[model samples]
Target: MESIVMLSGNVKYTITLDPSVWIFDDRRQDLHTYFHEQQEEKDTLEEYTKEVSKHWDREIIEGAVVPPTLKTEKKYLKEELLTGTFCIPFKPFLTNAEVSENAKNLVIETVDGMVTIPLTVAEKMVLGFSKDGKPLREDGPIHCYYGDGSNYENPIKNVVSFKIE
Candidate 1:
């Protein structure tokens, strides 16, 4: 089952899993902490400014001091499906029996959390698993596209092509 897959958009290309290839450290920080901290700081600053303004005769600057905008940081895991050593294309159809047998091995970790590879990719890689359920191959060229999740003018334009080798 040798096939070629191509993709575009946000993607990372790596032939194999190398510890050096991991861009982020394995530290999981609470995403909400940063936001809450910023909010608290902003509130404290506003209160202090208001108190200080009362002592001055001039109308203190109003609304000019903007709290730092809280931007969500993208969390990178130790293993990400797109960043993993293996690349599998999306498969749309599988029989009940095939799904039952292969679905267990299709789960992959993403930045958003765990996601399963499409049925077709799972089927192709069914025989590629090892005794411990890990893939035997260390390198696979798979293309993936992380779309914006918006409706595209031509939906197929975002289609990724991959070949099973």
Candidate 2:
């Protein structure tokens, strides 16, 4: 099917990925901003401590106020889903397929040709399924991108399947 990509080869399970539903996934990333933006890593422990301290202080001062308005949150999310460009990490689907321990490479089957990369690196790949608020049906069920955004402009197109070797 145009919306599915099969993940097979040296794996415990053969899985089918449907990019069409990824728009609803919480983990989907904005494709437009992903390549242009630089993210700063924060200390996880410190961030957690600060958030907990803030929550404790708020609860102590206000005695457990009602939660934030879901109506507003839902509105914003709905707008984004309708107009925002998006992508999802390829790693999750690949991990779900459970690559066999002996597998060392990931061979991407594209419309152009087969492109091979070390499985270690492929594990971090991001898949661009939509662009400019539209599914990339012309050349994709997905376009494979290097995790670091190196090939964002020229992503591997027409991803038919992923073969682990």
Candidate 3:
């Protein structure tokens, strides 16, 4: 006698698992998450600065100087270049920084510590971060301005800037 296969009411579903699928990468995942978090933090900071900058003046710390200001004289205009503004942060030895012409974006290091000048979004993008994901710089023609903070100002040593004009 031939046995008949039962196809009664109950339907059983089988889910096949592929072990080869990428479940987790403790190292790479962590690194990626870290970078993402850093980018978010940077964005938050930039946003906060953009909002708060409308009110307060920008100042940098120097050796035993109480909130030093980096002012300049151009065309007989005694301007508080770094006051209440963002200075452009750049590599200490880059040549393009001279474009500002007022030393408005210039920052000096004192024996006591480092000082930073405020910079605008344009200045920050041009001075901070590389086209290929590297350290902060002050070269190349200015291009692009990121406001939402998906990226960050690559924290280069002794560097910071804020807008003036």
Number of the top candidate by lDDT?
Answer: 2
- Per-residue lDDT tens digits for candidate 2, residues 1-165, read 367888899999999988899998877889888767784445768988999998899889877875677579989988888888898877777778888888999999988889999987897788888877788899998998887889988989998888899
Q: Ten-residue segment with the worst summed lDDT in candidate 1?
A: 125-134
List per-prediction Cα lDDT, in the order shown. Answer: 0.29, 0.85, 0.28
Error of 2 at 164 (Å): 0.7
Give per-model TM-scores. 0.17, 0.79, 0.16
Model 3, residue 81: C-alpha shift (Å): 40
Candidate 3, overall lDDT? Answer: 0.28
Which residue pairs collide, candidate 2? none
Off by over 4 Å in 3: 1-97, 101-119, 126-143, 147-165
Q: What shift in Å separates residue 114 of candidate 3 from its native position after superposition? A: 35
Pull out the clashing pairs in model 1.
3-163, 3-164, 4-162, 4-163, 5-161, 5-162, 5-163, 6-161, 91-120
**Better structure of 1 and 2 per TM-score:** 2
Total backbone collisions for each predicted model? 9, 0, 17
Q: Which stretches in model 1 have alpha-carbon errors above 4 Å?
A: 1-105, 122-165
Error of 1 at 121 (Å): 3.0
The deviation in Å at residue 102 for candidate 1 is: 5.2
